[model samples]
Target chain A: MATKDILSPLPGTFYRKPSPDAAPYKNEGDVVKKGDVIGLIEVMKSFHEVQSDADGTIASFVAENEEPVMAGQPLITLNI
Target chain B: MTRKVNTLFIANRGEIAVRIIRAAKELRLKTVQAHSVADTESLAVKLADVAVNIGSPAASKSYLNVEAVVAAAVASGADAVHPGYGFLAENARFAEAVEAAGLIFVGPTPHQIRMMGDKVSALEAAIAAGVPTVPGSRGRVETPEDAAKVVELTGFPVMIKASAGGGGRGIRVANSRDEFDRLMPQASAEALAAFGDGGLYIEKFVASARHVEVQVLGDGYDVVHFFERECSLQRRRQKVWEEAPAAMLPEDVRARLCQSAVNLAKAVNYRGAGTIEYLYDETTRDFYFLEMNTRIQVEHPVTEMITGFDLVREMIRIAMGERLRMRQSDIVMRGHAIECRINAEDPAKGFMPAPGTIESLTIPGGAGVRFDTLLYQGYTVPPFYDSLLGKLIVWDENRDAALDRMQRALKELTIGGLKTTKPLHLALAADPDVRAARFDTQFLEAWLEHRAAMLEDH
Candidate 1:
């Protein structure tokens, strides 16, 4: 088994849920496919969705929900 | 007389924080700049007499955190807290908390904030003050059938809005009877899911209306108007460009429009700086009250430039219990002024946020041109907040000259290392329609669409 990391493409506040009270797009151990949204990055008051580039199961979330992250920082680790 | 404020704590950031610090210093008030972990190197912090680290970089943990902000203000021994424009500026609970902690909240009372913050009550207050409001349901329309009856009189194209919504959220525009019925339930469900309150209201959508607002100052007893500013040039409901003394506003209409704002302010016994927004229909020469902003607006500089008044200073003085020294007659409008909001965005690529370090900065200057910004050489614009880098304001004796001055100023301005809305402003300054003052609230989106299409063809 091998693990791959999904890095943030932009610097901003990362949100696991689409909105404040909504359920997160994916949880740890959940299987995800390419193009599936894993989280959202809110920059300068605008939101950008973070899609998984490779199909895998989410091994762990490297960036906590509602935490500030920089561009190129690891957001989640996937077991491919 | 109320106790004088000697120390002012700015519980906000960006250019507005710097703007407040300058006003506080002029008033001889010691300034305390509140910053998040990320904004330690910001220009506001650099200029303030003292700086207080409130919390982390996220706004929710810092600027918008009411408890953290109040505690910091109290600990800093600040006599007054200035919530500049956004964040906790209009939050009634925040105002109450600041006052409870024995610090003056440099704006309206908590009651006024809460009243104007609510859509239905604010409309009721406007009607009570004899202000002309858009023709719609008197209050909340709880049922679709009730909405139908109201729309019969006002006719097609009505807006269904959530009572607790702001920032253009929880809104739906229904064009006809069928559309109204179709959207009502869906809109209600969306509002409920989003805001936790399903309460909804309706207003007749004013197509092709210009966004004009009157700037007002009050001392809890006496109120005065600084005339009007036309901000019809908006993108996605956010004002992009603003000008004072709305273009082509007939003298009689201007008089009425300004008077209506004063009436509303006086009715609420409003204190400090506020803006009364209106939707003006050029075709009928009728202006309807949109809502009231209980704090200073981002576009306040345009009004200040035309009137030759320091609005921020006056607001600070008013907060210290000083009476408005100047009367309405003394606040004469001398010239036309324009403001273009320069944002850290790529206008060509759908105004996408482009946050990067300012490798270099060349601020435009030369008489009548003012650039209020937080950008400095080597400063990195954080992605945690708004994209607004600064506002480029220009004033001249007349509208034509002001437009020309704006063009000159935009050309002189330069900010290296990131794409900005500067190009958009440059294009707008040269536009024939913009120069002719032929536009409405909906004009910019259409113009941008056409411009994009033209770019594609080329």
Candidate 2:
């Protein structure tokens, strides 16, 4: 079966790193476990951590850091 | 720094934006409206001097987009921006951007917004001003152990509140240490999801308290209270019915309540119209400062009706650097006024948002009646914004007369397309305790639950 990609559950600004000048939580080709925080999404001054529900190797990052993203948009492609 | 505001851009939608446009027109200021895809044909857009499409229907891409709104203002040559409640109304960053663009931000300064936006800090300011606030932690606590210690000091039945929370989100009641332990993580998670800050604070929970608030106006230096409003009729911490000159308040208690509101506003050097909310325990006859809404409140019209003052007009004038036209002694409470928020929700179905086209519309009218709505016969109530479709307000010689008028108005009003809170208002009007003015914050919820159970019983 093909690996499932992680998606943003809410509409907000996507952030690859927790804060400016910090390394991203996950990157391409990195193996991630279920519930591992992959990125952050901020909506109306609120930030929600986007987690990978399925453990898999990261295929690609669908959205750039600090860019606006919509609900149900793909954040990352994964290879189980 | 007093600049003449000839044109104002309203960066919002719904009844509030319409309210602002009407006030601007009264002031002879040209109005520019910014709309998202959801509000292309909204009443505010249709009524403005010019309407500019900002972006998509989603708030993040449209209404809340500060750059888009500012761009629209610049393009339309608007000298000032009126962010009519919600969206970017309290957004400090957006306010700063408006100032940087050389456009007036028709609210408090950025510093004031940031300082008052955080609940913990605002509470600290209230305490420093000697305002009576519920005793609790001075700042946000990080761990369960910290929360427990704070709870112990504040005693049992404490409320865990998110520092960055509002609109009834990110709040949990902890009856004991075990409950605190069970709810802390959930509260933090919800807070982090709702507000960017997961910081939590504890406060003594005052059960069965009346939600009384004092309205104040300021021009940066001078501040005055326009008296108080009782908003005890609420569901899930959201107010439904609000009336001015809160009934059952002693003369001394009322004076103290209004004075405390003025003291806090002066301490902050507040500007424009704001509401200082308080929790009044009728049993103890004591009041505690809850929080200050640094923008025009949704129920401001009730206070306006009784005081014979136009609050929105005052906000615009204050933004233009005009001094308050009236003083404390000049302000007089003329009559009783009550406002009922008409929301597009099904009260029987758990207050679920009922968004659809209005197939038919008939607003109530008569003596001492006013309906501030944006709904037309074919108007489609979009699910993008708040559920409040309009406000039905009435005024009379006394509270009883006002209540009777409200009941009649509710009966005359009709929106055939979708379910609304009209039935709920009807039930509230018929409740004995509510009619007698003995109800508190929990009255509406309890009454609704009882009604639902009775419906099930039948």
Candidate 3:
């Protein structure tokens, strides 16, 4: 019914994979459920999981891997 | 040749930006405020003559991003950069970048930063310059087994500290052998978590220690001291209250502390504003060098209020290659000054950072009362940066009078629709130990714990 974008809940470095050598939590164009973990935001040595809020087809990631991001900045756009 | 800096680019945020802008304007120099996208409406932007969007609100990508900051300075046509304290202040790469971009770095040289940045190297430098330092492990204790050797040498009641940590994080005090055995791994884990380095060092813990520091100014040749400031009142390793002309130090000890700071400054060929921190054991009356901060300190207002010198203005002038006019003897301390850091924190709730919009503000005033802040009505306090909203400094002819004035000032000041640590400061100013100027770095934490227990009983 609507297209929504996932925004980082805090300001920090956005990590695509769980670890440097691990596979990314979600890839572009992959369908993600509402509870799926999409990325991680690391701030002040603490990490917070950025989860998908809506179950939708993956549109594209706005923030690159290991990029610094601010709170409320777009991380991924989901096309429902 | 020393070049004239006509315009200064401040690569910082919050009240420090406002402080630097006012100082720059006083010298008739054009000021450029570097702001993140979040700080577009900050007071520094309003006060400065020009504003440049550096980057995002995240410090690592904005104020701390050397390339972005240097680019902003270049774009704004600034001839010099004052990093201010905290973000990128001690970063040698940022200083080198500013100088490489043909702009004056308002603090120390990159070499000086590197020499003093690392805790081990700074201790070595202090020893080399004949500045007495706390006895500890010569280098990092790589393993837990190595820690015991240091403990045997330093004895029990040892302090385990991270080599790359500051602002009080990465430190754990172990009192006995059992505690030391239990805490070494914990301390190393925290150090690795905080600074990405598990490198830990051990030092003999000073039980009755007073945090005293000497403020120094240098021109890469001559160095001058601004006496001392006592920052014994701290919370979780951060200073809560600061005062100049430290209370109750012997005259000879004061002379030695000042001279030791000067010795280290001259040894490093330090330039601009700097501070040499010392841990003074009250019982033994021995002072050991802590570390050298190669930037203008947050508590500089205390020294300025007492010595009547514009430290920020002098920093700008020195960056422009102008010689310091006043000799060490010419600078005099006439009055005692105390400063309370007005942070946007909820003291009752364990000093949690309470960031929100200020609906209104009523500041204290009159003679000897100085409120340095960027806060105003309708401004939102961003949660991204430091919790500091401003500094409340009061000055008087003596310590007793200064303390009394600070109590009155704390009462008169109010910020509507925001929870702050004003109530806690009011309590501190009234406390018996604080009134008597008797405190150590652990005083605030103990006081806070005591207050919580008292409230629980009620």
Best by the TM-score measure = 1
After TM-score superposition, the amount by which residue B404's alpha carbon in candidate 2 deviates from its true location, in angstroms, is 0.7
B445 Cα displacement, candidate 2 (Å) = 1.6
Docking class of 3: incorrect
State which candidate, 1 or 2, has the greater DockQ.
1
- With a 3 Å backbone cut-off (N, CA, C), the pairs that clash in candidate 3 are none
Which 10 residues in a row give candidate 2 chain B its minimum summed lDDT?
A: B449-458
The fnat scores of all predictions, in order, read 0.88, 0.00, 0.04
Which digits, one per residue and each the tens of the lDDT, describe model 1 over residues B1-458? 66778899999999999999999999998999999998999999999999999999989899999999999999999999999998999999999999999999999999999999998899999999999989888678887778888899788789999987988899899998889888999988988999998988898888789999999999999999999999999998999999998987999999999999999999999999999999998988999999999999999999999888999999999998999999988999988999999999888788888899999888999989999999999999999999999999999999999999999999889899988888888888999999999999999999998675232101
Task: Rank candidates by TM-score, best first.
Answer: 1, 3, 2
Reference-based lDDT, residue B377, model 3: 91
Task: Determine which window of 10 residues in candidate 1 chain A has minimal summed lDDT.
Answer: A16-25
On residues B51-125, what C-alpha lDDT tens digit does candidate 3 reach at each position? 999887677779888899999999999999999999999999989999998889999999999989997799989
Error of 2 at B202 (Å): 5.7
Point to the candidate with the largest lDDT: 1
How many residue pairs clash (N, CA or C atoms closer than 3 angstroms) in each of the candidate models, in the order given? 0, 2, 0
lDDT of 2 by residue, B326-416 (tens): 8899998988999999888777767756667899999999999999988888997765667888999999999898999999999999988
Go through the candidates in order and give the C-alpha RMSD of each one to the true structure.
3.6, 7.6, 5.3
Cα distance off (Å), candidate 2, residue B83 = 0.6
lDDT for B397 (candidate 1): 92
